[model samples]
Target: MKKKTVKQSLAVLMVSFMAMTPFQQTAHGKSTVEINADAAILVEADTGKIVYSEHEDKALGIASMTKMMTEYLVLEAIEKGKITWDQTYKVSDKVYQLANAPGLSNVPLRADEEYTVRELYDAMVIKSGNGAAIALSEVVAGSEGEFVKMMNAKAKELGFEHYQFVNSSGLSNYDMLGMYPEGTDVNDENVVSAEDMATLAYYLIHDYPEVLETSSLTSKVFRPGTSEELVMKNTNGLLKGKSYHYKGADGLKTGTTPFAGSTFTGTAKRNGIRYITVILDAKDKYGQPSSAERFIQARELLNYGFDEFKTVTYDLDSIEKKKKHTLPVPNGKEQEVTIKVDKPLSIRLTDEEKDKVKTTLNLDEEKVNEDGSLQAPIEKGEKIGELVIDTNEKEEYIFDRKSSDYKVDVYAAESVKKASWIVRSARGIQDFFVNLF
Candidate 1:
């Protein structure tokens, strides 16, 4: 009997371990990180370098992930003095009905009651309160219709692609209890690509930064010390004390729906390097929608980013050329001139790729002589060429990798004047005689 009990316990543990990993991998070899989702992406926050991606450009249901755009606009309005944290928003009949709507995530709000912007912001973001989102939108744009316009306009301005917002909230129009913003179809839901969602998250963190203070919170009290008071727990399961509870995870957002499945936009920082990961429509082993698979994929995705990759500095001080780079200064006081690179730069790379990196010196055309030597009368700080660092990686960057990302401009440190005719003539004559001998 005891032996049977022990066997049962071992079976349970093994099942749990295999359940966390939903995809296949190579046997008896180094583990390859793969995500179980319809669309997924991992990007380095500092460099915008794409670490891993699968069908990142495919547009899918975004679910509540649409609120991220709302968060961005709220922060922008505050920065521009259009709104204040202390400002109050009075709930109306529209918000009242939705706040009381069943089978939806919301904080109960009383009609005609005023709630501060700070409170509603927390309710909407931390609790995914549908009614609070509409109230805040009304406060920002005077109506949900105008706010929907603001949401779409902001997406365009931020360079978001494969994205369309029918309402300020990520909730499907049908879920809005027939009160969805005007001019939007009642059957429509917000749609965005995995890469587009990452773009919005990047701008939110880089532009506002303060959103983390609320997003990272595992729980908050909505309308505390009152009859309507309730504790709003963050939907992001990757947060501390949440289901996944990954270390270094502070803030982000998560969403789930019948059509969208489960989607999560997660971010975490370790050793000064932060990574943002998006999992869209994650599923279980049977490829069915799941509530836990999204967070499971998020944990693995963050693990791949923080474990397999690292940030290293590629500076000019350490590189050695085969020979000292020298440029001839014809008819100048000095026969030759030498210039050096300015400084070092930081780059993101995997541990294995560190040894694969190399440096190249490219001389700008027309800036130097045919033989790669500088002519006389070279001015100080003159442009010569660039020092470029190249990394041989199989994956491409998420954005158009800029030359400025890996190349630094080189310039002459000092000026050199032309030599006198007598001196030039003497040198020319001396060279001719030497060659004759």
Candidate 2:
């Protein structure tokens, strides 16, 4: 004879319809910050969600901002125990030549001088020193060529499709020392989209948070206690006391070249919320200084992210806490087992969307047996269903077509084992006697 089974119908909860309201202008209306950048983006640091973007995928030269990759590699080396902050590295003749070269931002280094890895890192980050970048690259990878390979490999590993690095620093092939064979017309400049840059910044900060301690420095000495105490000032203008000083602006890198125009990757914290902004190929226009415009654009983007969006956190634990839904177990020692959500969810939304946000839970019935009852011997962590949450927000942008829907797997909270016929009979008799009392 076939064993008996139970079947359950799908449950649907109709959340509020207010979530379907069309997007409307806020009290301040749309942002008036004229983003003069060829490509720019603002992202929440924690969630890595794009808050505001304009031409974010446009490819452009990143200039000195390329050093961010170099910084990442050095930090990685430190983390892997290949190098240490207190360890020292000697300056090579090539590094010396580049440092003394005319018109390049650099902290002067001498062939006879040995500097700590920490000091050189400070120079590279604080001053955008091409020489310091090369010195650190050589120390980490034995040669700048090898370092560039590692950089590209890392970019690929990080899911970058359109970024290329020709040098550890963001210098052009011709400008870099031996970047290309003599007299080659190869345009070997670092190229990346604003989106990729933002992604890179996100990982760099996420993995090595200590980098912010260095990037946020407004000014420092490159060779303190030495005769050649070169003063290194932060290239990012949004730092405190700068011309475009923003209130909460902290660390990040800046870049500019004739070909790349001006670029900046800035991060700031306000009221415990952090934002990262990227501006590439920002040009001087409308009576604004060319180099200064990137900072202004970055400031505006960061501010927009903070002001326009608020975080919404959903506690999945509450689902199990408030009410425990049990699944009927067929031919088991226990008649039912509880279920729970696998993980929590969070999202950022504008005030308008937040006020209208709605969620609904739906269980997938296809997993049910023919009789709608789960089989006994069910594992504690088995995925029995999924919870579907619909915020009712729609993306009208040409780039994104999917609705604001999130799904998380629901799992069995406890195990259930099959019971023998004798055990079931004894349990039924015991229950009858207890109820008679």
Candidate number of the best lDDT: 1
Global fold similarity of model 1 (TM-score)? 0.83
> Candidate 2: which stretches are off by over 4 Å?
1-33, 174-187, 270-272, 284-289, 316-338, 355-383, 392-405, 409-437
| lDDT score at residue 127, model 1, on the 0-100 scale | 96
Error of 1 at 100 (Å): 2.9
Candidate 1: Cα lDDT at 414:
74
Cα lDDT tens digits, model 1, 227-252, are 98799989888888887889999878
What 10-residue stretch in candidate 1 is worst by lDDT? 1-10
**CA lDDT of each prediction against the hidden true structure:** 0.79, 0.74
Model 1: lDDT equals 0.79
Q: How do all models score by TM-score? A: 0.83, 0.77
State the lDDT of candidate 2 residue by residue for 253-358, as single tens digits. 8888876667899999888788889987665554222688888878877777777777666544434445557878856788888887766666667767766655
Q: Please name the candidate that would achieve the greatest TM-score relative to the true structure.
A: 1
